[model samples]
Target: MKKVLVVILVAFIILQFFPIDKTNPAPTPGMDFLTIKKTPPETAEMIRTSCYDCHSNETAYPWYSNFAPASWFLKNHINEGRKHLNFSTFATYEPKRQLHKLEECIEMVGKKEMPLESYFVGHQDAKLTDEQRKLLIDYFKREKAETERKMSF
Candidate 1:
């Protein structure tokens, strides 16, 4: 038992050396979803607080992100999120893609699949209330409709 404990401690210490990269891509305000869509302040703040950490280029790594194994998991999750929908570069997506992304947003939020449960473990502030969830779903639905309408023209 003592030997096992010591090994675990040593492994943890070694893992600390392999810190995750915390660099965020440079901000592109002109291409950002919030800016281009002219999202209301309240809605924009909610989106930023609840989604931007993983979904946008403005990731603000928490203190624990300096640690290793957990940091690795976090980095991978963030990369996947950005790949699926990078609001920071939303304006660059073609109109069809933009509409699809907005549809995905509505579906995800409406189904309560977003703001992943594990995320609230570290960021309680990101947790959405029932009202907030409804607000976000409504906002996404509106955005999707607007995108579709514009594409028709």
Candidate 2:
């Protein structure tokens, strides 16, 4: 049992040397949300602080992301989030997809389902106050409506 325990500890230590990649994917020109839309600075900052880590190509990886298991988790989350909505590739999506993503964004923020709770453990600043939530929720609704209107034409 003692030998087994030591071996497991050593294996875990060794795994740390094989840390997961935390590098942000290179941004593509003409496709990114910022490039396609004129975002308000305050809203952009809020989105950057709250959602970009997992959702965009601008993830600000922290020190813990250098560790093996944690890095693995972070990488998985980033991948999954991008699949759902990659702001970095927003305009590259079909127009209907773009509108659907905007609608989903509104639903997620309105229900407090985004910026997942696990994310908040390491990112207290991502916490949205009631006022902030309202602001974002309203913004998301308006964006969704505008996108829908544009798509209709």
Residue-level lDDT of model 2, residues 56-95, one tens digit each, is: 8888888888887878988898999989998888988887
For 33-148, candidate 1 gives per-residue lDDT tens digits of 99999999999999999999999999999888988898999999999999999999999999999988998998888888998999999899999999999999899888889888
Those runs of model 2 whose alpha carbons end farther than 4 Å from true positions after fitting are: 1-4
CA displacement after TM-score superposition, residue 26 of candidate 2 (Å): 1.4
Q: How many backbone clashes does candidate 1 have?
A: 0
lDDT of 2: 0.84
Model 1 per-residue lDDT at 77: 97
Worst 10 residues of 2 by lDDT: 29-38
TM-score of 1: 0.97
Q: Candidate 2, after superposition: displacement of residue 104 in Å?
A: 1.0
